[model samples]
Target: MSELKTKPTLMEPKTFIDGLSDEKKRNDADALLTIMSDITQQKPTMWGDSLIGFGQYKYQYASGRKGEWFRVGFSPRKQNITLYIMNGFSQYQHLLERLGKHKTGKSCLYINKLSDIDVDVLKQMIALSFQARFDSEI
Candidate 1:
């Protein structure tokens, strides 16, 4: 059997947040960092340079393509904040209705302006994602 492509690395969890350049983006990053951190009950890690990743898991496809990825993560991108939830939003359309301004793909939720969304709703979304992933695994 093939091994996982990448195992977790010992990156300084806090440094990733320190590297943000834009004050607003940096602050945004910090806010998200705290939310994701709390939801995952895990420290943040730098997945690449721009992504702040939380807990991780391993996956191997039927075809034997294997990889390791964080349970949840986000990137403070130039356009917007991109959240990486392992599951998609279709499962939680009701929550999205009250989540305020955002967009979604299969596994990504995009928020350009934080002020446009209810922070509490955002927290629930995070918690829902965390719980959904946990429960799905059982």
Candidate 2:
């Protein structure tokens, strides 16, 4: 089996966020780190240099490919802030409608800035996604 490319790293998350050249993106990344940490009650960790991950889970696909992944996370990309919902977003259309300006790709939700979305709704979405990780364990 091939290895997972985006495994967690010992790299400090705040240092990574602080190194971003874009000040706005840096601030947003910090905000996301706080939000995710608060929701998962877990400290953020650097995943593959860019991703700031919260809690973790072990997943084994039907094909027998098994790996560990963050329960919920986000990356401050050049174009937008990409949030990993982990469990995909199809079941959250109702919440998405109220999410304001954003785009989705599979389990990722992209937003240009936090001001572009309702933070409370985003928190709810993250909470639900975070809860789903534990739910699947049971």
Candidate 3:
């Protein structure tokens, strides 16, 4: 069976964040690090080359494919800050409504400008989602 492509690596999450070429992205990453760390009370780790992750969980698909993945994480991508909200956002619509300019996939929250979002609302969403995933509350 094919393995999961993005697994935890030895690279330091902060170093990766520091190496980002865009100043705004770098600053936004720092803010994200702080928010996620404060909520999870866990140090962030690098997942593959460009994704910073925190905590972890294991899951198996119906077909028996299984892997470990971060409980929550983000990637400062070229297009936007991509947040992996593992518990998904259905239960967080009220928070998303107040979150300012952003977009979402099934599990990814894409933010172009950190200044455009309500950080407190974002923090709440992160905390609730992390708790849901980490504690299996969902």
* True-structure Cα RMSD, model 1: 2.7
**How much lDDT does candidate 3 score?**
0.90
- Model 1: how far is 62 from its true place, Å? 2.2
- What's the lDDT for residue 53 in model 1? 79
Model 1 is weakest, by summed lDDT over 10 consecutive residues, at: 129-138
Write the number of the candidate with greater TM-score, choosing between 1 and 3.
3
Task: Name every residue pair that clashes in candidate 3.
Answer: none
Tens digits of per-residue lDDT, candidate 1, 1-138, equal 656444455666467666767778778888888888877798788776677777766666666666777778888898889988787777778888998999999989899867878888888877877766543331
Best by lDDT: 2
Per-residue lDDT over 44-76 for candidate 3, one digit per residue giving the tens place of the 0 to 100 score? 999999998888888877677878888899999
TM-score of 1: 0.84
User: Which tens-of-lDDT digit does each residue in 36-114 have in candidate 2?
Assistant: 8888999888899799888889877777787888889999999999999989998899999999999999989999999
Error of 2 at 135 (Å): 8.7
Better of 2 and 3 by lDDT: 2
